[model samples]
Target: MNVAFFLIPKKDIVYLKEKSTMRQALERMEYHSYSAVPLIDNDGKYVGTITEGDLLWKLKNTPGLTFHNTEDIHLSEVEQHVQNLPVTIDAQIEDLISRAVVQNFVPVVDDQQTFIGIVRRREMIEYCSQLLLQRKVE
Candidate 1:
């Protein structure tokens, strides 16, 4: 099956721009209760992913940094520890399993490397589980 079938389109998900402030990222992440979110460039291309750990580390490493001052810090300043590898729209289901194993959600990009959406690991797992159950029933 095509990976796109499982894609949660960009319009339905929350993503942050590289130029956004650290405070904004924190607020968005907190509001959505997401541990991580996809980061995009000014041109809407996938840059990387930012996680709660990244923010915590940034706060710890930056001296005199506080919640009040996060607004002054750009998300670009936060170091992303996870590469959060992305797959192309044409990629197959088999192509996504390994990545899904390590990531909460696999970022999906188009041929131009534009940030299209994400394929949540839960979706993949449920699909596979359904297939296995069907085989057992047969």
Candidate 2:
């Protein structure tokens, strides 16, 4: 299947700009109910990913840090150990499943290599369930 069919379009994704603060990132994650989110540069390039674990680490490492103080910290300042999973607009469902297993979400970029969208684990599971149900009916 076309990766685009399974991908959550960039418009539907909850991403954080490079300049966004940890607090803002946290809020977005909470609002979207996502464990991790993709990070994009000013030009809308895919930079990396930030996770709930990264936020926890930041909170623990920076004792007494406040939202006001987070301005001093950029998304780039926080080290994100993100997986560089293969991103292809034509990726197969099996390929997506493999990538999703390793990384909760795989970042999707356009032909220009611009940040586009993501394929979440939950989305994959839901898709698989639907496919199985359809198979059973057939």
Candidate 2 local lDDT, 114-138, one digit each (tens)? 8889888888999999999999999
- Highest TM-score: give the candidate number: 1
After superposition, which runs of candidate 2 have C-alpha atoms over 4 Å from their true positions? Answer: 63-68, 84-86
lDDT of 1 by residue, 1-138 (tens): 999899999999999999999999999999999999999999999999999999999999999999999999999999999999999999999989999989999999999999999999999999999999999999
Kindly give the stretch of ten consecutive residues in candidate 2 with the minimal lDDT sum: 77-86
Model 2: how far residue 97 lies from native, Å: 0.6
Top model by lDDT, which number? Answer: 1
> Would you estimate the TM-scores of all the predictions?
0.98, 0.83
lDDT for each candidate structure: 0.96, 0.81
Model 1 TM-score on a 0 to 1 scale: 0.98
Model 2 TM-score relative to the real fold: 0.83
